[model samples]
Target: MAGVILPRFYGCYNCRKRVALHDDIVNKDFVAGYRKRAYLFSHVMNVEAGNKTDRRLLSGVHMVADVHCGDCGVVLGWRYEKVYQEAQKYKESKTVLAKYKIVKLDYW
Candidate 1:
């Protein structure tokens, strides 16, 4: 197993449940709230989404749902359920996990 390599992933900060792989990251220059740093991921696992609600964000009004850790039920970030702006439509169905809410699970 010396030469074998494991995929790097991010886990819930509270429960350490695997949530997303590092390779799945779509954007790293994202902000959660005012100045809180966050990352956008194309996919995630071991997380539950809350009810979708239309909220006005920095970019524009978007339908989003809060995503929580499945094991600990802690709010990590929000997922874009619907993007109203045509320019932001690429964010649809994507999940954003707060940088402060996830921890690296594997060695670099």
Candidate 2:
């Protein structure tokens, strides 16, 4: 976290939806398929929208939903709603963008 960091972009699961900028990534380890990585950006270009679900996960208690590519409907990661677990409650307002579901775009 030092000098002149350039920006990097990432796309959605199926479509070329620019979902994340380099700095928007919350995890230190920017490894693909990183566990429960969240981002502030969603599909940049046109990809469909307003598709969300309120569902639970793990023990089928905490409410979670897959944040998919609206155009292609590929599962991104998840959005936490109501978490039953004590640790997961903090993620209630965050969206986890699946690393494997996105492709890193080259810097222009």
Model 2 spans > 4 angstroms off: 1-4, 28-60
Q: Model 1: how far is 43 from its true place, Å?
A: 0.1
- Put down candidate 2 lDDT per residue, 7-67, tens digits, no spaces: 7878875777776676655543322242454453422333333335555444356565556
Q: Give the poorly placed runs of model 1, Cα more than 4 Å off.
A: 1-4
Task: List clashing residue pairs in candidate 1.
Answer: none
For model 1, the run of ten residues with the poorest summed lDDT: 99-108
Per-residue lDDT of candidate 1, residues 1-108 (tens digit) = 899868899999998999999989999989988799999999999999999999988898999999999999999999999998999999999999999999998654
Top candidate on lDDT is: 1
| Candidate 1 global lDDT | 0.94
Score each candidate by Cα lDDT: 0.94, 0.57
Give the local distance difference test score of model 2: 0.57
